[model samples]
Target: MHTNTSTLAASAVDRLRQEIFDGQLPPGTRLAEAAEAKRLGVSRVPVREAFAALERDGLLEFTETGRTVVKQLTPQDFEELFAMRLLLEPAAARSAFPLSRKQQQLLSDNISATRKANSLNEVTRLDLDFHQLIVEASGNTRLLKLWRSLRTELELWLGYLHQQHRDRELDTRVDTAGSHEGILDCFQNRSAAACEKLTREHILSWREWLPMAELET
Candidate 1:
């Protein structure tokens, strides 16, 4: 019974987190426990528990008025998230080279899904997952765990980026997809150096478009 209750609380938390990340519950929106509990058909206890968990994950800020609001990712948050990815992803790509058949297939599938994604949020999720799959395929449990810990903040940053940008030209999407394909091809061909170089270039490309000062401020 206790375990089931805990699982329910976790489910509630994940659902709430997704809503916030997908912009259904925007930053600065208040989360009233009673309202959420009623909406989710869960008791207040679980709602409160979920709120506390989200707070710890840096997704929510609790106030003196006993209200919780979704937190916004500051510029430092974006910088740190990208910085960590820069450190981890290139290494993962290099490790992924000499790829096993399974890893190659996974990368191919991720690229296909990214192309097929109907919405911007879907594409963003696929992009994040593609990097994660590479890291996990490297067979480094510690790296995978650390990356998961960073995902909440990363998702928040991606959500902010998606919301702030409106232009979605086909050429831009094709360019992004081509970058992933380039790294995948390098991995498939067992070219570790090439894979690492492409991965670094892909990450650094963010600087070409993303506004550094606006995001930081």
Candidate 2:
């Protein structure tokens, strides 16, 4: 029963998270407990718990009126988060090499999953997993925890991007894969400097690609 309740909580949280990410529950939209509880087919307890969890992650805001609403990503927030990713992911890439065959396979699997992803949401999830796998493979628990902390906000940003651009191009996929491939090569060659450079470049490239106006609004 304990395990089932835990699973329900997770499910409720994920459902709410995805709704926010997909713009179905847009930023600043109030989360009404009774309404959401009915919509999600769960008791108010799990919904309230999920709201608290999301608020802690900066994905939701609690109003003085006791309403919870999705939070918008400010431009500063994006800059800070990406800066941190630039700092950490490259180091992770440098440490990623000498990977067991299993690690290499995992990377390959994520890449494959990205290719097979049919929707923008699916692709976003796979991409997140791909980078997260790299971070996790770094054998640094602290870095992994930091990355997890950023996941909710990152998902919101990525979701906005996907919504703004309905169809993802093949070129975009290839470009992203190339960046990951470069990092993988650096790992394979045991060249930390090169990996770091690639990671920094990848993070910085988002500046050119992201919709600045949308983020600010």
Candidate 3:
């Protein structure tokens, strides 16, 4: 019974997370444990668990009146998060050089998958995973933890950006793959400095892709 409950909670988390990410449950949307449990055909126990997990992920927040609602991201949120990314990711990527064979393979596989991904959601997920693998390869426990803490928010932002691009009929496959290929080449060549420089440049360039004007809408 305990195992079943745990499974249900994990499933609820995935469902709720995808809904939130897909904009089905947009920011500021009220969420009730009872209603969500009914909708997911699970008991309130699992829904409560899911709620706690999402709150930890920075996707759910309680209002002054104690009503739980989806967190509304602001332009400032993006700026602040990207600022931290600029600090954390490049440093991590710098140290990630001379990666283990396993790490290299995983990153290579991720980029290939991203290139072939049919859905924007898949591409966003793989894109984030590519960065995550670099940070993990750095072998710094604290740095990995810090990066994981920001991952969900970064994912939400990237997903939004991808959707905006799609709406504008932009195909990002080439640019995204091209950037990763360059970084991977640096890794292949064992140039840590080049990797760091390219990684920083890659991240900094996202400011151009940021959907600043769409934040209010």
- Give the best candidate by TM-score: 3
Model 3 TM: 0.91
Q: How much is 196 displaced in model 3, in angstroms?
A: 0.9
- lDDT by residue (105-210, candidate 1, tens digit) is 9889988887877766777777788888888887778888888888777777676667556375354456657778987887876578888888888888766544
The per-model lDDT (C-alpha) reads 0.79, 0.76, 0.85
Model 3 lDDT tens row, 30-67: 99989999999999999999999999999998789978
Scored against the true structure, residue 73 in model 1 reaches a CA lDDT of 57
Residue-level lDDT tens digits of model 2 in 1-217? 7676667778988898878887798777888888988998988887888888889878899888887888865777778878888878877867765577788788877777666666777777777888898888889899889888888788788777777666654655666666666666666765667766777787888776456535447
Models ranked on TM-score: 3, 1, 2
Candidate 3, superposed: residue stretches over 4 Å from native: 168-170, 211-217
Q: What's model 1's overall lDDT?
A: 0.79
**Where is model 1 more than 4 Å wrong at Cα?**
63-66, 169-172, 212-217
Clash list (residue pairs), candidate 2? none
Deviating ranges (above 4 Å) for candidate 2:
1-8, 167-169, 213-216
Candidate order, lDDT descending: 3, 1, 2
